[model samples]
Target: MLASLAQRFIALTLLATVGTAVSAQTLSSDQRVLKIERMAHGLDIPWAFDFLPDGSVLITEKDGDLLHLAAGRLTRVKGTSKVLDQGQGGLLDVLIPRNFDRTRRIYLSYSKRLGRGSATAVATGQLARRNTQLEGLRDIFVAAPPADSGRHFGSRLAEGPDGTLYVTLGDRGDRPSAQSLTSHQGSILRLNPDGSVPRDNPFTKQKGAQPEIWSYGHRNPQGLTFAADGQLWSVEHGARGGDEVNLIEKGANYGWPVIAYGRHYSGLKIGEGTTKPGLKQPAHYWDPSMAPSNLLVYSGSMWPDWRGDIFVGSLKFGYIARLSGQPLAEVEQIRGDETGRIRDLREAPDGSIWFLSETNGALYRLSR
Candidate 1:
């Protein structure tokens, strides 16, 4: 875990203070000057970001704005689809695939208006040469049976090593729907680059099952990432204190509303206990919910000691959580005023850490 490295970081400058820092046990006696620099500012609800082939960055704001940040300058990208922008729904995630340079294509997940209600949708488009607009935007996949309430729209996107796309969807405040394969609610979907269902998907041939469904029974899974070994991992929000980090597999049942470690908000027990015969247990979990937002498996290019470690952002506690070890437990809490309500965590191409703070409405980079 990076907690031990925290002791070696000596602050070189002080910014406006917003919260107290947590102390960690020293991992090494070698001290290095830690720099927390604000990269971009004046953002509003910036939900997600991804690196472009040209070394710039694309950031999405929950309110339907796509931002381009390069060399300390910010530009608003045009041609984004219209989003609901209510409750938890909005333009959420922006992703650049491995073949970005060749295709000039990018993907987005957002809350789209379906009928009178709203549902999660994924769209793809080409970034203009100027990086000032998105062109030919079109929806490839849209979750079904939209919900009236904007409570749970789990919209996160990740590209697989094999070029497929994985999209996470929430239960839409409908608990029972998680167990229903007829609906896309509370499910992880696997699709080809062109938005077609992969023939090898676990439920593709199953009767009465949604062909796109890869895994189900999840509750508000907002964080998803692939490990260096190609192992897929995800983190989801629980009702009260059951935030979870799960190792995802094909055709697995994650038992939300059927089995859970935490109870309902009203102090009532959830499901038929924590474990069921067909349900998968969380690889790691949090009680007193941290409101986890994004998940990252560090490459350790900058800090070799952190290679393969897990880093997650906590929206509720305003900190970045570091998890490592065989069993995957929290080894450190990296917090400060600049980290307030971290909405996203990304590892830059150069191996530094960049994150968006909702409370501060700015982008920050952590480096030594």
Candidate 2:
């Protein structure tokens, strides 16, 4: 199904608020004439997906299903690790290695149930076409100190320009853990393609520090993506209001509960105001909480005009916010027929925009 611009704009206008920080890009009705095409449906909160060079797509369902979508059909990819599928925990992110055509390796992040506890774990395996399953599965990274809580398993993956992979891990619903160096929770981890730690990891020599940590102090980062310039970016949820879009920096500390633009959910202040010494502020923040899920700095051909603009999926508002400029600001909000609880989004190899909608249980593509 194709969605018209008139229909999309009506939804966007309804959700549009007046106070978002604006950029130099002038708002015009002419640019609203884009289209949304339904790519797939009947998915169960399809969390993340990556496209193979052969035009096939691999998607991770939160319920532990690894599905291959090709030629208008979906097939279950077997040999997946057992996922806990509890509240906010399960098969979360799927990524095709940068050299997938040669290696056939895929990376996955899931909530691993280990004995009586569970934690976010990343494993890699070779994809086999003959049997439609992964082979030689082995975990390369696991968040230290397992937890019983089923929330905040930020598992989005993005390949850095240097061929290393970046993984986002949440604070495990334990606020203080984010500020601690001994824990892998609430930090962005950088690892070599084969799951080895980069020798120059930021905290490699710090006493009582996890060598895999790249950046620390995050709430529940759900989105990870590389900008056109190869810089890494993330989007994370705040307590009551302050959802954040951060530019991931090596060795930097992104202040979480201790210093946020949000409150404690009970209307109380969070941390030492919005700014404190040695803590990083967000590039952009949502005041009333958009419940941001993922970030995409578009370089797609379909939207040449938006080549360098930043796009983020907003879960709470059921829309995509088109942002641009440094210290990014919200420029526009886009909504289509199936755009409900946006989960993750990406630009296809063909330069089209593809996204998964958790609320609609479907996938969609924005194309010219």
Candidate 3:
């Protein structure tokens, strides 16, 4: 399927965006024509963004800025949490809950200073009616056993079908901690809206495990989302070439360090080969590591032919990868001059695709 899609991949670049009239590119792939436009620019390391109920956008800058973009203007949203802003630790994902229209509540995931080191934390706040500030912002959950390392916070948030929040946390560069149930490191946490543990959580009845843990044995899971069918999925950074997209399951263990398809940065083998008896295998993996940032399972409202497909932003390769079909495969790679270091890929409210480019410090939109 991958080879066939590669042979059929066709792209036609049109006029680049200059004044909000022309598009940056008119790309053709997967039998669809996609128009890419630069929606906003001059951002400083915009990591993640989500659309609000009023057609505005809330963007998170890794340097601790919450920007509200509306009417072609960027306004700084005050009263956000103070982040560490060291290494990969800083302001990250922004999530607008499904009930935002009634609650005006928003969620943010960032690297919070904990004791000596920084840990991934999730916070909620009420967006002021004026959209210029956040009111009553408070931390909901923070990962435990913070490490001194400044890498791999893995701060991404997704609201489950049941209104629960799921947060991804990295291993803090500690490989073995992924296998430990006592620590929240390298795990995906599921919590109620108020930061309390769900009564029916997978580990709530377990003796030593953290009650917030939904799944374990992840290295640095940055990309997290749910499909229309309510199934959860995640994409995580692997050692050298084993970047993976896994189907997240409750109480399941995804083998990291113990069994991985990639080798260490030192070119040494990881774990005891790829396959293990009990560990879960990835739905798909990339060799040479694309430094995946976010995952989106497209609904295909604009391009209906591509429904149920997966789109991933590549921070290292500077492109958006489209994965589809059963047993998932990388069907196409969308690249353009505007696609530098793609940081976040999200399906907008109108079914258009919005992505952040760290290399360009811009936000771009894609539609048919």
Candidate 4:
């Protein structure tokens, strides 16, 4: 009787272990059926996309143009402001106001030509249907100093929960400017709707610091969004390998040139070692380099299983990566799509995932 009981117990234990292994594999499977339907094409390096209340989308092309798409049709909007249109400098991001349907207000970020170089500028305008073409119509805000640079002009904008606009500027390929309190480059800035600095900003009380600066020491923050926890998160491209997903906090310093998990393009060592006393560490880092561009946290009803997952677009691998947990473990990779460079990713009002392909200048809608 004792020998028979031992055999039965061993059999049950083996079955339980196999069951657990199978469950884990199913969670991380790449078999997700993602159907990509082309919505619009013929755009030039479409950088970002925002959805309107009536199911229309406003897309920004890197070559300084804005195209409006509605009901599977494309229309070039008129009255677009003049952009610098140099290498990596042009119109970048577009966002609609929280109450867009009632106000018809839109916000934009672009590099405006100024003297020797160009400066990243933010403007608010009204979208009006005049004559036959839709017009951007006006500018409500432009940066003051109007500085210029060819690289690292991080022009990403995100609206906060309090109606304030948050803007990010790269170091303009200048390493020292990132450490300068007076410079707007390599910093996350906070401002009111009309270009005024908010009093509650982190550096507003500091004498030498720019009042608009919310946080500093970023290389090139391409992705910014507020998560379900009401915490802001940003993903920046590291030099060679160290792409990072960071939890943004007010007045915090994220060590850039001073310290990084990545090395320079020429394979030289970057500033100081990886960890410092005061600097914040990224929640996650990609070693082999994913070339992360755009990030969005899934909060839709269509994919209930992906409700809390964070979706990141990759330019190097040409895949959409899904991350989960506080430290971000790779859950799955959605591959075999357009294979073009994905500049931006946004979740539409109808719970569909929309991706903007920079090389093809096309919008792809992904539905399960």
How many residue pairs clash in all the candidates, one count each? 0, 2, 0, 3
> Could you give me the TM-score of model 4 versus the true structure?
0.88
lDDT of each: 0.87, 0.84, 0.88, 0.78
Candidate 3 lDDT over residue span 245-272, tens digit each: 9999999999987999889999999999
- Candidate 1 achieves a global lDDT of 0.87
Q: For residues 152-186, what per-residue lDDT tens digits would candidate 2 score against the true structure?
A: 99989999888899999999899999989899999
Question: Where is model 1 more than 4 Å wrong at Cα?
Answer: 1-33
For residues 276-338, could you state the per-residue lDDT of candidate 1 as single tens digits? 998999999999899999989999888888888899999999988989998999988887778
Give the number of the best model, judged by TM-score: 3
**lDDT, residue 244, candidate 3:** 96
Preferred candidate (TM-score higher): 1 or 2: 1
Least well predicted 10-residue stretch by lDDT in candidate 3: 8-17
RMSD of each: 8.0, 8.6, 8.4, 15.6
